[model samples]
Target: MPSGSVALSARPEIIGGPPPGAATLEARDACAWFGDRLVLEGVDLVMPKGKVTALIGPSGCGKSTFLRLLNRMHELIPGAALDGEILLDGNDIYAVGTRAQQVRMRIGMVFQKPNPFPAMSIRENVLAGLKLARLKCDDKDTLVEQSLLRAGLWKEVRDRLDSPGGALSGGQQQRLCIARSLAVYPNVLLMDEPCSALDPTSTRRVEETIDELRGEVTVVIVTHNMQQAHRVSDLCAFFLAEENQPGFVVEQGDTLEMFSSPRDPRTLDYVEGRFG
Candidate 1:
C-alpha cells in the first residue's frame, strides 16, 4: 500500500465464491492504506475459476497493489493494512486462524523480475516449496521432473538439472521461478508485470507458458501493456487514481467487452490510448 489521491464512491459487499454468475475469487469493498494515506478504496472484483483475469491501469493506479492483496502479499510491505473480505472457494482468507503461510502456499506469485534461489540448482528450485512444507518424499526426483515438464523447462534444461539456477537466460530464469511456484501445487497464480523485463522472444515463451497454465489454476495478472492483457486475459479490471481520493476500480467485465464497450468513459479513454 502507498499514499494516493483516489477514492471509491460505492462500497460493494462481500460476494462469496461461485455466486450466481460469479467467479472463483471475489473481493468486496477492499480498502488498503499505507500508514495514514489510502491507496485502494471500496474495490471489488471476481476472477473466474481456471480462467485468466488481467488487471490493467497506469502506474500507481493500484493495479499491482490490488493483485498483491488478492493473495495477501500487500501485508508484506511495511505499514500496509486493509479492510475487506477476500474469498477463495467461499472461504474468507482474513478470518481468524486463516494462516497467511497456507494462503501463500495455495496462491502463488511471480514478480516483475525473475527471482530464483541463486545457490540452488534447477532441480532443487522446483522442490523448494515442498521441502519448506516439510513434505516427506521417498521419490522427490519424480516430482521435480514432472514440475519442470509442466513449466515447459524440462526439455531445455533436462541435461543439466544439476546446473545452478543463475546460469540460465533471463527467460529461463523466469520459467524456473514459475516452476518453483508450481511445485507448491497452488490453486491460483498472481503475476505482477511478469514479462516487463523480458525481451520479445522471452515474453512470447512466458506467454505460451501462461496459455498452457490456463484451466490448471486461476490466474490474475497486473500489467501496463494493454495488448498483452488483451492477448492473455478472459476478464479485465480497470483501475484509476484520481485527485483527492484513493485508487478504485472503474470497471470490470469480459475482456472483449471491456475493450469494445467499456461502461466508464475513463476506462474507454485509458484502453483507447486517450490517456494512461
Candidate 2:
C-alpha cells in the first residue's frame, strides 16, 4: 500500500453550507488562450461552495490554467486572453469594474511550492496579506492564532512565532502559506498541487488540513495524484486534451463514483493506470 493514504474523518464539513447564500463558483463557456493557441476551451464547471473539487489529469492538460482563471491569474501572462464568465454566487467576476485584486482576495491561491518570505518571521508571514491587500486588521494576535490553527500549525509552532518562516521544515512552511491564504477569509481557496513537495508524513498532515477546511471554505485543487484526489476531494473533474486539441473536462462527479465506476473509458483508464 502507498504511504500517502489519507486518514478518514467522521465529521461532516459543516452544518449545511456557506452563510445564508454565498459562493457557488461556476465557469460558463470558459476558454483560455495563450497568444494564438488555445489551452482550454468550452469548459463549464460548478464548484460547490463548501466542497472540495479536485482537477486531475495527465500533465499539460490545462488543469492549472483553469485553476488560475478562477482568481484571474491567467490574465497576468503576456498575450493571454480569456473569454466567458467565471461567476461567484451569480456575480460575473470578469465583468466591468470588478477589481482583480478583490477577486484574488475573495478567491485565494496556494502554489505547489511553499513560498514564505525568507526574512519575515512566521507570524509576520501569516499577516503579510493584509499589507499587500492594504487592509488594516484589528485583533492582530488573535488573527495569527486563528490562521495558524486553521492551517494545523499552531501547536507545533506556537512557541516560535517570532522565528523566520524559512526556518520551518518544508511542510511547515507550506502550512504557513496556507494560513496566510486563510487569514484573508476567502470564500474560495485554490490550491495548485500544494503538497506535491512534501515527504509522506508532511503530505498527510497537509491532506488533513485540506479535509478540515472543507466546510469553512470552498476548495479547488489541481493535482496529478489520483489517490490524493480520491482521498481528499468531494468532487473530481477529469480533464484531457488530445494531441492537438484544447483541454476540456471529460467527466466530473462524486469522487467515489469517479474512482469506482467512471462513465468514460478514458477516465477509468487514467484512474486505473491503464493510460494517462
Candidate 3:
C-alpha cells in the first residue's frame, strides 16, 4: 500500500457466504488530492444497505473519483492522498493494519468498458476472483451457476460455459463481468459508467442486472445520464465543481424527490438538461 493508502477487512465468514448480504457505506468529510491539488472535498454521504445510490454530474466533477475512494482504488495512484473516513457497516475501512486486497474483495468495482480475459472461458472468468482473493470454493460449479444466475446471465450462457468470455456479445460480456464481481461475494459494488459504451439494448440489460442486484449487493454508480439514474437508483447525489474548485455534492436526496423537486437550482438545471 502507498503512504496514505487505506484498507479494509471483515470476518472470514463474510468472504463466501451462502447468502451474502449488503453493507451500509458512509463517507464522512472525505476529501481527495493528487499531490498538491485537491480534486474532491468534504464529501459526506450514506449509501444504505441493499439499495442503489447514484452519483450524478458532468465530467470532471469528481463523481468517479469519489466512487474510486470507496474501495481504496484512489490510493493506487502515485502521490494520491485522502483525508477523512470511509465506513463499511460501521467499521472504518481505513483502520490501521487492514489490507487493500481484503477491502477490494468486500467492495468490487465494475468499469465502463466490459473487460473479460479474452482467452479465459466463461466459467474460468467467473471463478477468477476467488483465485485472486485466494478464497476457497467448496463447489466451483455451484458458485459459478449461482453467480451467473444472480447476474442474470445464466440462462443465456449455461450451455456454453466453456466458451471464451470475450466471445459473448457486448451485453453478455458486461453481465459476465458483473458475475465475476459477484463471485467474490462483495458487499458493495461500485460502477463507473458501466453502461456508457454499450448500445441501448446492452445498456438496458446491464440496468436490469443492477436492479436484480438489490437486496444482495449495495451499489454506488457514477453516471452522467439523468434518465438512467432516474430509472435505476433509489438515492441520487448531484456533484458539481466550479472553475478552479474541488468537486462537492450540490444536492442529494431520494431519487424521485431529487428529480421532481430538487431544492437546489443547480440540480434542477442539470437534471432538466438546461445545463450541465
Which has the greatest TM-score? Answer: 3
Using TM-score, rank the candidates from best to worst.
3, 2, 1
TM-score of 3: 0.93
User: What residue runs in model 2 are displaced by over 4 Å at the alpha carbon?
Assistant: 1-22
Name the candidate that leads on lDDT: 3
Worst 10 residues of 3 by lDDT: 2-11
> Model 2 — TM-score against the truth?
0.92
Q: Between prediction 1 and prediction 2, which has the larger lDDT?
A: 2
Worst 10 residues of 2 by lDDT: 4-13
**What is candidate 3's lDDT per residue for 1-276, written digit by digit as tens?**
222111222222324432467999999999999999999999999999989999998899899999999999999999999999999999888899978888888899999899998799999999999888888876788778777877778989999999999999988998899989988888999999999989998898788888877766899999989999999999999999999999999998999999999999999999999977
Residue range 1-276, candidate 1, lDDT tens digits: 012111111111112211111127889999999999999999988898879999998888888888888888999999999999999887898889988877777788999999999889999888787677665554567657656765778889989999999999999999899988876667788899999999999899888778877776788999889999999999999999987779998999999999999999999999999988
True-structure lDDT of candidate 3: 0.88
Clashes per prediction? 5, 0, 0
User: What TM-score, computed on C-alpha atoms, does each candidate reach?
Assistant: 0.89, 0.92, 0.93
Query: How high is the CA lDDT of each candidate model?
Result: 0.81, 0.86, 0.88
Tell me the tens digit of each residue's lDDT in model 2 across 1-276: 122221212111222212221267999999999999999999999999879999999998999999999999999999999999999989999999989988888888999999999999999999898778876665678778777877889999999999999999999999999999877777899999998998989999988988887766789998888999999999999999999999999999999999999999999999998877
